[model samples]
Target: MGPSRLHLAQGALAALALGAAVLLQGQAPAASASSDNLTADRVENLRLGGDGVAQRRHMWTIFADMVSDEEPDFVHWQGESGVFGAEAAKRPSGIQGFQRPKSIGGDPHLIGAPIIAYNLFNPAAFAHIRAQGLYRKATLDRLQLTGGTGSVPPFPAAAIVIKTAWWPVAPEGLTAMPVWDPELNPPDPTGNPYLGWARVVAVDPTNISQGKTAAVQFVGRSFPGARRVQLEAFHHVAVDAAMAKQLAGDPESNRTAIIALGRPIAVNDQLALVGINVMTHEQQDWVWGAFWWHDRPEVGPFAADRPSTLPGPWRNYLMQAAFDAKTPRASDAGAHICFNPWLEARFPDGGQGGGTVSNCLSCHQRASYPAAPFLPVTRGAPNLREDPALAPDRLRTSFLWSLTLHAQRD
Candidate 1:
C-alpha cells in the first residue's frame, strides 16, 4: 500500500492534504483561476492539456520541510488514520475529489521512510502456483473462507515483518529521477491519479521454508531499541542496486527466494498495524470492462536491446502483470489478482489464531491496517514489467505462465 493503510479510510478524513491533490485544489477549467475551486490552486498554477502538471514543486520535492514540520502529523493524520470515511466514504460529485490524496508514503514533501517498491522474489512461477490443484483449492479458500466465514487462516503470523521503512536522500543532487505527481491544481490532465516511478528501501522475501534467518521486527512507538534478534535472507540484491540491472539476462526472472514463516502470530505486539504480505491483483473476469483503463499510450522507451528478447516462446514476456490498473476490470472470474508464491499467508497457529489469506481477505479485514492491501501499484513507471525491458528479477514465472495462460485458452 504505497500510500499506506489501504483498508483504513473510514470517516471524517474530509480534512485534507497529502497536499490535497496539490495544496487544496480549485482552478483550471481549461485554465486560469482566482478560485473556480480545484482546492484553491497552488501547486504551481497547474496545467494539464498544455502538459504542465506534477506541480507541488515539480514533484519529488524530497521534503518541503515535512510540509512545514508535520503540521500536527498532517492534522492528526486527517482525523485518525482511516483518512476519512463515514457518510459512506463520499467523493462522487463528478468523479475524483473527496479528499485524502497526497501521501505517497511519508507525507509533506518527503524526507525518508516511505517504502512501496516491489519484487519480493518468489519465482518458479510462485513455485508453480505452490504446486497447484486449483492452487490447492485456493489455499483452501485463503486458509478458509470469510465474512460469516468457514475456511480460516486469516493471518496468524509466526514471524514475517519488515515494519516501517523510509530512506531516500541521495540521488546525487537529483536532476531527473524521482516522481509522484498526482495532479489537480489547475492540472487535471485527466486528473493524473498516480504515476510515481517506484521507491522502496528493502525487503526481498521468498524463503518458503529454506529459512536463512529472519527476525527483524520494528514496530511503532517511533522505533526505540528497534530490536534485532536474527538476520540475513532479505538480500534484495544487496538492498536494490536496481537489481543488478533488473536481474540481467533473466533466468525466468532469476530464482533464489528466501524466508518462509507460517504458524500464527501477533497478540500483544499490540500495535493495531499490519503489513508485508504483498499480492492483490484482483479486477477479473477477463477484461470485465477492464475498468476502461488508460495510459498504456502504446507502451514506452523499450529498446535496451530489449532484454535479448528471445526465450521459450518469448517466455510469456516474463509473465505479464496489471493489478487494478487505475480502473481495469476484466472478468471470467479473474484478471488482476497477483501475489503468487502459491499465494502464501499461511498462519494457523502462532499469535492470533484463525489463520489468514483471502488474498484481499474480504474487504481488507476491516482494516486498522489489518494486512492492509491498498495495492494500487504500477500507476506509472511503465516498464510495465512482464518485460518492461527487464529488471523485476527478470519477469516470467507468474507461475511459469499458467500454461502460457492456459495456452491462451485452447
Candidate 2:
C-alpha cells in the first residue's frame, strides 16, 4: 500500500484499540477527543502561554547561542580526556557524561559519522532525577525489565538533554566527505567528521499536557510536548578556510573561526541552523523544521549530499523532503513548527517495524525503567504501539534515556 494509506490503516488500528480501552474502563468519551476542535491559536497559547511567540523566539535564540559558544558548559568530550576534568575518571558520576568509552570505534554505518557523544543534562533535570531517590546504577538496571515500576519520576518542563558529536569538520575548499575504515563493520564513524551536529530534546509539560488524548492521559502523569532540536557546525570547513586565507592557523586558532561561522551565512557559510522538531500533543504528527534550503528550487550549493552508502529508503526519504513544504501554516511566528513528510512516510502511522520505520514519540514512549536486565531494544525494533503488555504498571522514566546509564565507582 501507499504511504498515506498505510498510515491511515495504522492510525485506525491504534484509535480503535485506544477507544475500546477507554470505553471498557468507563471513561468519558470527551477525554479521548482529538485536539482538532481547539483552534490553532488556542492550542499554541495553551502550550506556550500568553507570550507564546516571544517564548519560542527566545528559545530559538538560546539554542542558537548554545550552539555557537566555543566554551559552552554543556559541551563535553567523550572518553578519558573529556571536559569533565578530573571527574572523567569516574564513569557515570556527573549529570553531563559520555555514553561510550573513549576508545570505542565509531559506527561506520551511521551518518554524520560521530566517533563518540558527550551528553549534557541541565542542572534542574539532573537534580530532578536524583530527587526520585534512584541512583544511576539502580535506575539503569531497573530500566531493563519488560514490565514493573521504577522509582524515577517524570522529567519536568524545560528539562533539556543535549548530545554533541565528535566528528571532524571538513576543511575549507573540499566537498564534505565521509571518513571510513575498510576493516570496521559499520565502516564510518558515528557523525560526519567534516561537520558535527548537536541534538537537543527539551521537555515542555505545558505543551504536552495540552495535546494529550485520553490514551496518553490514561498512562498517568505523562506530559504532551517533548521538543527536539538539532544544530550543525562546519568546524573543519570554517577553520580550514580561515587557515588558508591567513596562513597562520591551528586547531586552537580555528576555534574562533568555528564560533564566528556558527550562525547562518548568506550562502555556503560554514555553520548553519539545521531545523527543529516539536511535538506539542500526542494526537498530532511530530512537527519537523525543514532546513532553509528546503523551500528553494535548486538544491543550493551548500546543501549536503545524501551519502550514496545510506540505505535506499532513507536516502529517498531525505531527497523528497529536501525542498518540500510539509506544513506551510507552521510559520516561525505561529506554531513555529513544520512537518517532515519523509519521516511520516517512512514511519507511516508510527506502528514500528525496523530500521528507519521507527517513530520518535512511539519509540520513546517505551522508554521506562525495566525491573531487571532484559534485552535492550535495538534501533529498528518493532513498535509496541502503546501495548499494555509493553508498558510499565507504575511510575515510568518518561522517555529519558540517560537514566538508563550505570553509575561508576570512584
lDDT value, residue 372 of candidate 1: 20
Per-residue CA lDDT of candidate 1, range 156-205, in tens? 11101111111112111111111121122122222221122221111212
Please provide, for model 2 over 313-360, each residue's C-alpha lDDT reduced to its tens digit, 9 standing for 90 to 100.
Answer: 122111211111111122222212222221221121222122122234
Runs in model 1 with CA error above 4 Å?
A: 1-116, 119-138, 141-148, 157-175, 179-242, 245-410
User: How many Å off is the CA of 270 in candidate 1?
Assistant: 35
TM for every model, in the order presented, reads 0.19, 0.37
- The candidate that achieves the highest TM-score relative to the unseen native structure: 2
- Say which candidate scores most in lDDT: 2
Clashes of each: 64, 25
Which stretches of model 2 miss by more than 4 angstroms? 1-62, 65-73, 76-116, 130-135, 139-151, 170-175, 178-358, 371-389, 405-410
- Whole-model lDDT values for every prediction: 0.20, 0.29
Cα error, candidate 1, residue 266 (Å): 39
Count clashing pairs, candidate 1: 64
